[model samples]
Target: MSDTVEGPFFHGTKADLQVGDLLTAGFRSNYRPEIVMNHVYFTALRDGAGLAAELAPGDAAPRVYVVEPTGAFEDDPNVTDRKFPGNPTRSYRSREPLRVVGEVLDWTRLTPEALQGWRDRLAALRAEDRDEIIN
Candidate 1:
């Protein structure tokens, strides 16, 4: 059995995420409590589509936050993977079931600029992941 934890866990006030929803999270900085880094996320996907289609009865949706950090985001030790540069986009599964308190916007229906940003962010994340695996 593998002991590896697949994703970072986050705690929030409610579970309000659905697949394809773009979520923004404000991660508090460890160096400065007053500072918060905002990270966007495209909800968990299944077979290249939103995970919502994969849900079955009696199954509670997994609370996963896929980090989409921008170039401006500081590689804060407390908020992201220290091994990765800019801590590029990654999945952050919740440690315990917690409520979410953020906005969940559909990425497919968003304005052009926002959609482009999402695409760019995902591409960057894939590039970073590739580099990490290669090194």
Candidate 2:
């Protein structure tokens, strides 16, 4: 949403994304960070809980990264909307490849209120049958 980038940047903390979660991330090239991207969700191959430390150790652990048949939601926007570029609906996915920027959300834990709010959102995603990977 910042002027620096034209679209929204996905953000997830280390704790949010666990091993095997499905999610997407957008990466910005410019330090200023304003760009369009196509987001794709992948099955996390490794646990991201201590990703920073694992990467720092410099071993052949393959580190933290997602894997599997990558795909996107059919209805997901490939471009940023003028009104809410970074809003979840418009910005969650994009036309260009994005980096894994955040934790893959756990859809199963949706609270009643959260589920109610995102009912339409969940439908819009056109999620694949593989969503079961989260559980």
Candidate 3:
């Protein structure tokens, strides 16, 4: 991974948060609720966060918030070099808290069909027992 990454970073979630709220680690994993996450994840890409928001489990609407890291962060090892060749995802995680700065209202939303496709893919991964998260 690179030594550092620059960002006007973003985090996606179903949780309603106000500006200045601190997003910290130790929350349950969105992908696997059984595990408590050791790091808080975010992305430099706006739509990437949007996708995460869409996939987040809950009836509430997805939200993408502009954020600032309060401490050092690094590339998300789960996808950085393992899934993609490099950090094409611009994804990162931090053990420290990320402060919400603002929200993105104009982000692209997935179509119903596209959203179903992702759900189907996730189900398939679960069936194959391949939904392993590095954290």
TM-scores, one per candidate: 0.27, 0.24, 0.90
Off by over 4 Å in 1: 1-94, 99-109
- The numbered model that scores best in TM-score is 3
Extract clashing residue pairs from model 2. 5-34, 12-102, 25-99, 25-101, 37-94, 37-95, 37-96, 38-94, 38-96, 39-94
Tens digit per residue, CA lDDT, model 1, 49-135: 223212211235323233332223222343356554544433343222223333333322335575457556656866886799799
Native-to-model Cα distance after best TM-score fit, residue 132 in candidate 3, in Å: 9.0
RMSD of each: 15.2, 14.5, 3.2
> Which has the better TM-score: candidate 2, or candidate 3?
3
Query: How high a TM-score does candidate 3 get?
Result: 0.90
- In candidate 1 the C-alpha lDDT for residue 1 amounts to 7
Find the 10 residues in a row with the least total lDDT in model 2.
Answer: 41-50
- Candidate 3's C-alpha runs over 4 A off are 1-3, 130-135
Q: Which residue pairs collide in model 1, if any?
A: 13-99, 14-99, 14-100, 15-99, 15-100
In terms of lDDT, which candidate is strongest?
3
| Residue-level lDDT tens digits of model 2 in 41-124 | 222222222222122222243223333323333223333354435433422333334344333333223345753455444344
For model 3, how big is the CA root-mean-square deviation?
A: 3.2
Q: How many residue pairs clash in each candidate at the backbone level?
A: 5, 10, 0
